[model samples]
Target: MLDADLKEQLKAYLERVTRPIEITASVDDSAASNELRGLLADLTALSDKITVTERRDDDQRKPSFALTTPGQDISLRFAGIPLGHEFTSLVLALLQVGGHPSKLAADVIEQIRNLDGDFKFETYFSLSCHNCPDVVQALNLMAVLNPRIQHVAIDGALFQSEVDERQVGSVPMIFLNGQMFGAGRMSAEEILAKVDTGASAREAEKLKAKAAFDVLIVGGGPAGAAAAIYAARKGIRTGIAAERFGGQVLDTMGIENFISVKETEGPKMAAALEQHVRQYDVDLMNLQRAEKLVAAGDDGLVEVQLAGGASLKSKTVILSTGARWRQMGVPGENEYRNKGVAYCPHCDGPLFKGKRVAVIGGGNSGVEAAIDLAGIVTHVTLIEFDSKLRADAVLQRKLYSLPNVRVILSALSTEVTGDGQKVNGLTYKDRGTDEQHHVELEGIFVQIGLLPNTEWLKDSGVALSPRGEIIVDDRGQTSLPGVFAAGDVTTVPYKQIVIAMGEGSKAALSAFDHLIRHSAPAESAKAA
Candidate 1:
């Protein structure tokens, strides 16, 4: 199943194995089972430390395989062809099961090992979902670390009956101990915080004891990483507190316009950004959400209160908290979220395979989503509020050429109609005829662009545009002195990644200049 170059790469990665590992597959006589068997044979051929076996006695999911050491109690399984976005998860499972050490922090490993109760985690994922691997890999690592923890990464496409029974209309839907746990992208730290309960309190205590920073950034997207690197390069006490590092960039699928670099995936770019920032002395804080930004106090330090009940003080603050996918406020949209309404077509499109769906918008993202969904879904209805699509000429051409797609312009999405458990259709109003219509579909992908993440700063004296974006000067300075903003959260014209990085660097420099002017001696300033 693997190509020549892929085989060479797998061989090189498998050479790190120091222990014998066995792959036990419980597969039926189906085409998917044959594919899985072929993949296993290819893996076995790549390394001497790996071996494959068949098992029919175990009451496990068919077309699935388990990775375990000879005498270890590890229980990690993949209930589908772990290719595409999940190929990394498969490789990591192989390596880690063969005695390759994990890169997780010492404390996190200990926390996983010390968990008292049993955790049977089943994660439903799609091959196209860029966010599913993180959750799968995390749970696999937990399973490898603790015998009490077991994880099975199931491909929702392959297990249609189970997905329908569970009402899973979204990718990366997770169930724990036979109950719905959560959904969407989740990191190891976030998962730990949810299960460990006391982890947040401990983290809050640690953050409270931290000293005031010279330059503190409040996001971890392109802008925040650039600001952190620039500030740390100045030999200042730099720190970054982000709700989740990578911001909206993590949700992006493809980036062909990042200059110099031809193309890259979102997760790959986010990892590179984080790695670049870590090369500096900047203190990186992930999963730290900022709740409020306090103006300069008597101590000449600005404070940012976190949702975790801890507050951080800084000499200068940079707000780069980026943006999130704008939601359609129509009725039933919220109620049907993940049930039939999804924001990312790449992640959730496979879940609606052979089913009718609608793409709500006529912009670049919306058109692209419709074009992509045309291949996988039975029919795609593209609804636009404007008279014409706002996408580029080439994209619009490609979208119109799709046989399975239909376009409706000057149509406003009125309401999302769904059964209590899943979506059945969508309601829309035709502006030209002043008439309403409904389209039967299994899913709705909303691509109405982004909303700035500045709602938390609304009452903090920070000036915001009518659209809620942070208003900044040419130097990236917000209305609040000693405070700055950058990226999509600011009034910047373009929300591109490169522009955000430049704005972040400029904001850092402006913060540094402000410090120099304010901290200088008054006598020297008067003489000058």
Candidate 2:
């Protein structure tokens, strides 16, 4: 049975819910002196407990504090933008202030509690980024351990002005005293080392070894992901840098013939593949752009600078930026992308069920889309610029097997016909005989050959084939020293999810080997 006093207190607390209170100047007040007067009045109210202030010191005023109760002031110089990891940190901070102490290791807590000087840390990130969540929690733990350190997060998208002011471009950006730390996901120890300088400069530099791993995998696509997994599982500290978590796999619409999984979507498969690699201690970064690569110290470590100028050093680097669907570059393609024009049949296939659609291109993707669409749609017209379909014989056989599918050989898309709101049909011309025709379609699936996402590596010393694939060895080693390449960006043929995953595992293992070799001297030196 609850005590009478406790029961009454609980009831009172439940009944006292109110808006987060604040005292501010009236909208009509324009003079600076009037605003100052408003501030004085609010402070008086705060002292008397007449009102609770959410924001400390009204906008554009110096901070003035009142600790009526311990940790009760929920104040900020800037309104809580609360985006990305910072949002989670804000919640944690509120929870701590609201009375639930965070559960960090006692040692980590002790280290933070002893800090004496002011430490202001700002993290920049995007909410949509997957890896930002982990790094955000790490920072929150540090904040919980030390009350002297003021932590803040700025949303890269919503707070574009702040981001531009700080020159932030990517998610999971860490800025300590206006100096850029690393980007994407980072460890707590690295951050702590930078702030708490207890070691000698030479020792600190060695301890702050940016890239510990020998091989750095640049993509989380099939090839790169597989490489990282294999290398890290074999006791290598392989690091993978990727713009998005799943890489090209995330864009794939569907996977029907990838060995074990008979039917699956791109994102789902990528997720499963990612989960497989998560068990290892690989430093995987999703939604991070690899900006520049230059050789680091004599240990063969290559420092990779990210979009926000966060540098990481690794001995081996793998370039596995896969290919994307070739765009039509025509007018209506961009305007009605999600409206009616799509790239993946698996992702957008169900939406067009029983509707008429056109499959553009004569390659394997085009043939496969035509075959797949024929079963789901009322009719499927397979359009090809060349006189003959370029797909394999088995896929061509399947295309011919579908009664509702028609093969338009030697035809090119002149223009996509849409009703301004959505796609309606397409106008095409024959390449061989120069004939023009129009066909109504509810959806148009583009299945042309893929284009490599190597625009950034144009001058990065990594050799790209004439077809734009990164030239890599069987073990995912690239042309450049201390750099490896894998997956769709490489010369590997047959762009399939399983193959990419396999390649990723292999690349990871190779990178691990490189890491082991590089760490040997350091471990021996420590022993000595």
Q: Which candidate is the best by lDDT?
A: 1
lDDT of 2 by residue, 1-528 (tens): 234654454334423322232333212233433443453443333323224443334443222211122443332222223333243443444344334555654755666677667766776555444445455656655654555665555445444456545544345667776788666455454455456665224333442455466567777777777777777766656677776667766555557888967887665677687788788888776546777767556666677766644667766777777888898877788776755787766545545656789889988878987887677679998888887888999999888988898888878788887877678888998787777889988788888888988877777777889987888888777776557666777788887776777776676666666566767999999999
Worst 10 residues of 2 by lDDT: 60-69
lDDT of 1 at 313: 97
For candidate 1, write residues 1-528 as lDDT tens digits: 999999999999999999999999999888999999999999989998889999877788988999999889999999989999999999999999999999999999999999889999999999999999999999999999999999999999999888888989898999999999989899988899889989999999999999999999999999999999999999999999999998888888999999999999998999999999999999998999999999998899999999999999999999999999999899999999999899999999999999999999899999999999999999999999999999999999999888899999999899999879999999999999989999999999999999999889989999999999999999999998899988999999989999999999999999999888887886587889
**What lDDT does each candidate get?**
0.94, 0.64
Question: What are the per-model C-alpha RMSD values against the true structure?
Answer: 1.7, 13.9
Q: Candidate 2: lDDT over CA atoms?
A: 0.64
Candidate 2 — which residues are off by over 4 angstroms? 1-212, 251-268, 295-300, 353-355, 392-398, 401-403, 505-528
Best by TM-score: 1
What's the CA error at residue 455 for candidate 1, in Å?
1.2
Q: What does candidate 1 score on TM?
A: 0.98
